[model samples]
Target chain A: MAKLDASGFLIDLDGTVFRGQELIDGAAEAIHTLQSLGKSVVFLSNRGNLSRAMCRKKLLGAGIRTDERSIVLSSSVTASFLKKHYPLSKVWVLGEKGLTDELALAGVAMAQKPQAADWLVISLHETVTYEDLNLAFKAASSGARIIATNRDRSFPNEGGHAMDVAGMIGAIEASAGAKTELVIGKPSWLMAEAACKALGLPPGECAIIGDSLESDIAMGRLYGMKSVLVLTGSAKLGEPRLYEPDIVLGSIKDLTELAKEGILL
Target chain B: MAKLDASGFLIDLDGTVFRGQELIDGAAEAIHTLQSLGKSVVFLSNRGNLSRAMCRKKLLGAGIRTDERSIVLSSSVTASFLKKHYPLSKVWVLGEKGLTDELALAGVAMAQKPQAADWLVISLHETVTYEDLNLAFKAASSGARIIATNRDRSFPNEGGHAMDVAGMIGAIEASAGAKTELVIGKPSWLMAEAACKALGLPPGECAIIGDSLESDIAMGRLYGMKSVLVLTGSAKLGEPRLYEPDIVLGSIKDLTELAKEGILL
Candidate 1:
């Protein structure tokens, strides 16, 4: 196969760059090399708990120097999507401050109760209460449109794994007998489109590098971009490939070498 | 078709006898008349939040006189099932005080942490926290057996509908990538067996009456009992019957007339 000469790069955060608070070995150097080569790099994350500024700070702490503008989050994408579609709708949120803050900044009116809202936004929050879930259920049952940031079942954490928004979403859907209208995250074309717009490049010239095939690679494939699977996160070495990516690497550290060999020129 | 000629009655509470706090028309009279006819009346409920004593009290409040001994609850069945099968197991509970009280009375040791438990028991608890769900997820991912009290997605309440234990169970299952090992409630053979034991009759002579075809009618069909679907609750008039029951009625109020016709003799 010919070498993959990609000018734009979209990368996943949690499993690709680091796991929990520890940085994956050689990830930062690979990013630095990519930047030195003039590749447009955008760090993407499905985690909606942290703002773009907070995410940039965390990236800096891990020796990968990136600014807020280079970071794209699901929360931002969701807010933008809602603003474009339902600009004047009242939204009820079951998420953290980052998500609500983004929605608020987008000028979306927040509903105090589910019944008062036109849309219900669900995300992962460690402190989510039963009443919050019940409210979401009631609202959805009452015909409120439900939207989710992502559908990740679990994510890498300091402790083995932590429940992700998918679990909560499943619960709400089961109780309400309704499915979410939109999920503005990896594997969804909306998120891929947003990232592509941010990079100022067409999907054909960009490559998505991440650990999860179900999200990162799947999103890239759906958007007609080069999908690169890294082994630093969710996908295992021998697991069946549900969605075939353009390339596979043992870790993000190999990206520089692959570039040197003209494999990722 | 001949009459039902059922000698023992296994009735559902929430939808059949009462809707929220108000008694369903003719429900109390039907139960009283059944008792007057010397029929064995056992009230079966999938609600595990309340103890048998508490459930009996609620039945009394609805003008139905029933003793604690005549009530078979999912919590009590779960407690008995665990005691009989896993006598020396340490259990971690994600339920209300009623479930915990029942497990404690059955002499099951309660684990403080998920890691310390041999089994994880999940049910509906309005106050369940993310921490509780994470603990259950961790335990189940670590090979702990996951057992649920019931799997009702939503139950009838003062409001349109309230989220039931199914939501919690789905969340845990999605996070843990494991299905429940046992569900000791409606639609499950375990609960039907327990109810039959309480009525001191075989499944052949017992009739299961309730508002939900998914649970009550399904459970009866599973145990070779006469399934009677009542239209006062979850099941609607034209909904698809996944499992065909023996009989269908507009409401439990017609049970007396059916008895007079020897349909439920």
Candidate 2:
């Protein structure tokens, strides 16, 4: 492949930059190199369990210097979408602290009872109860608009895999007999738009580098941005090219090679 | 439309005999009347949250005289199925105390880790956590056989509807990329066989009377039993007759009227 140039970098966190608590080799240096080259970089994450500040702290702990403002989370995108579309609406949330914090910061009123809510926001949580499911079902049956952060069923954890938000979303959909009206995460235009806004650049000038073809690469292609797939994550090289990425590299370390070859400007 | 005759009675508990704490009108009297006529009756329940003892206690509290031997619960059916099919298997349970207690009684070895389980038994509980979901997903991905007590999405409670085992099942199926291998509850032949064994009668000689056509009537039809639908619960008069019941009544109180009309043989 010839040298490819980009003005803004949209990077994934869990698989590309690190896995669990350990940092991927050359990830921090690659981000620093891009920054030295005067490229605007935003860390994009589909995880809704942690707040942007917590995400930034984790990135910093792994030797990457990024602020909360430079972290684009699906929770933030969802909050922004709710604020713009359903202003001052009573909302019921089924997520962790990260998602709830974002909505509160957006000044959206939280509904104590599910039936009282005009909207329902669903995400992943570590302690979901049957009562929560009943509440969500009741709210949805009463005509509450349903929205989800993402639909990734399982994510790689310290163990083989852990249940993600998609599992919870599927359960709610099955019980409520309603589908999600909006999904503000990777593979959706909403996440891409949010990242572009953070970078202060147009979609044409931005490139997204991540591991999963279904989410990261699909999102990039949906918004007409360069998509780079790294192999240090969920996807493998020999897998079917369902969502053909713009470029496939062995790891994020190849970003340094792309820089050395004058591919990344 | 004339009073129907049957040998044994297969009755549902929640909707037909009682609704929550209040017993349905004439339900106890109808059962007593059937007993007085020397007819065998078995109470069938899809609820897995309570053990047979607890179920019997609840029935007795509601002015009915039924022993544990005459009650057939989904949990007991599941336990029996597991003991017969996956003998001495290391089972992991995701259910309430009733299901776990039944499995323990069956002497099936319990697995603490998901990967260590040879079988996964899923049921409903009020306090399911995300960690439980992750373990179930991991076990299922590692080839653990999945079984459920029932697949009812919701049950009618005092507050409209409460989420049931189907929601949890759907969530695990979505995350694990696998479906349940066996569901030993309503609409399954397993429950019918258990009920028939309890009554010492064949399916053809028994009649099932309940409110929901989807469950009680469907099971009866599946096993060639006489299906009766009562309109005191979920189903209405003019809805789509997906599974037509042999007879329909306004409530279970009409069973006495059927006896008065010389239908009880």
Model 1 chain B scores worst on lDDT over the 10 consecutive residues at B256-265
What tens digits encode model 2's per-residue C-alpha lDDT throughout B1-265?
6556678999998889888888999999889889888889999989887789888889888888888889999999988888888887998888889988888887778987889899889898778877777788888888898989988888877888887888888788877888888888898888999999999999889999998888999998889999889998888999997799988988898888888788766
Candidate 2 collision pairs: none
Q: Name every residue pair that clashes in candidate 1.
A: B4-B263
Model 2 spans with C-alpha error above 4 angstroms: A244-250, A253-263, B244-247, B257-261
True contacts kept of each: 0.72, 0.69
* Steric collisions counted per model: 1, 0
- The candidate 2 chain A region of ten consecutive residues with least summed lDDT is A125-134
Q: For model 2, how does the per-residue alpha-carbon lDDT over A226-262 read when each residue is reduced to its tens digit?
A: 9899999999989897788888899898888788888
Q: What would the TM-scores of all predictions be?
A: 0.81, 0.92
**Complex DockQ, candidate 2:** 0.68
| Candidate 1 residue lDDT tens string, A111-228 | 7778888998888888877877888888887788989898777876777788889878877887777888888788888888888888999999999999998889989888899988
Tell how far residue A96 is off in model 1, in angstroms: 2.1
Please report how far candidate 1 places residue A62 from its true position, in Å.
5.2
